[model samples]
Target: MRVMEAALVMMSGEAVVVEAPSVAAGFEALYEAEYAAMVRLARGLVDTTEQAEEIVQDAYTKVFDRWNSLKEPGGYLRTAVVNGSRSELRKREVRRRIGLDRPLDSGPDERDHMVDALAKLSPNRKTALVLRFYADLPEKEIAELMGVRPGTVKSTISRALAELRKEIDR
Candidate 1:
């Protein structure tokens, strides 16, 4: 019953109105609006820009697949991005352990102090800190996205900040 109107231009310069179902239209709008932010979120969690882009694309695909039934598409998409980033990190760790991947040789002085400090934190702590500070999400929302209790998020962030302070002081 819900419809969205879009304008299409003909080769001859005539304009025509097209009606799309609200579901598809809504998804299109969401993709346009949140794609950049989602990429940034993934970038915060992942090591490379390419990986962040891939993770965000995968998240969008998952969101598109279940858009109609989703209760909160934005939140679901965010969770998907976070999960994808976590999976990628896990795969990289396995590769490193199996000798298929070499450790990055960049020295601490070559990177921004804050970024280096964050990279040294455990995945959970880094994720909590990124979601809370970089993404600027509230604690409750971060808890839902990270699939942990709010109290756990609070503690993780507290520990992460302490660790960051110590790392930066060096």
Candidate 2:
């Protein structure tokens, strides 16, 4: 475990050194350890690497802002990234409707066949598949993150796997 120097503060005109380890160090370690995986997870939702990295960074910023209050930082960060990606998709949809967005890039070498197929799924199904398979999260956890019941997650995962198999078999 890494420990960073605590800070000193003046309380009632008295100087006191805080004993707690630095949140900045903790967050930095977490960022270093998880950034790549989080980016990949975000990519599963957002498609483009640049968009995925942006989503992850945005999510990390949000998570860092609320770090002290978060009971489960990992879960909180994952939910934030997922929510951020969903928000990005909504914005992209709006841009597409307004004809402000470019056509989605598509080329054999530029895309992962499996990931591309996953991206073609409905949003909820894609989230279910990514959380369950890519993140290795349990069904209950996925349900909570997606705001659905456990049964819904089960069915969603089942259907998503079946769909993926069909795509891969083609």
The whole-model lDDT of each prediction reads: 0.82, 0.80
> Candidate 2: worst 10 consecutive residues by lDDT?
1-10
lDDT of 2 by residue, 1-170 (tens): 33233234325566664434657676777788889998998887776889999999998988777777878888888888888887877777678779998747767787777877876676778888988987899999888898899999999899999998888878
Q: In candidate 1, what are the lDDT values of residues 12-79, reduced to their tens digit?
A: 46655453467668888888899999999999987677889999999998997787789999989989
Off by over 4 Å in 1: 1-20, 105-110
| Model 2 lDDT on a 0 to 1 scale | 0.80
Once fitted onto the true fold, the runs of candidate 2 whose alpha carbons sit more than 4 angstroms away are 1-21, 94-103, 162-170
Q: Which candidate should be chosen as best, given TM-score against the real structure?
A: 1
TM-score of each: 0.79, 0.74
RMSD of 2: 5.2
Q: List RMSD in Å for every model shown.
A: 6.2, 5.2
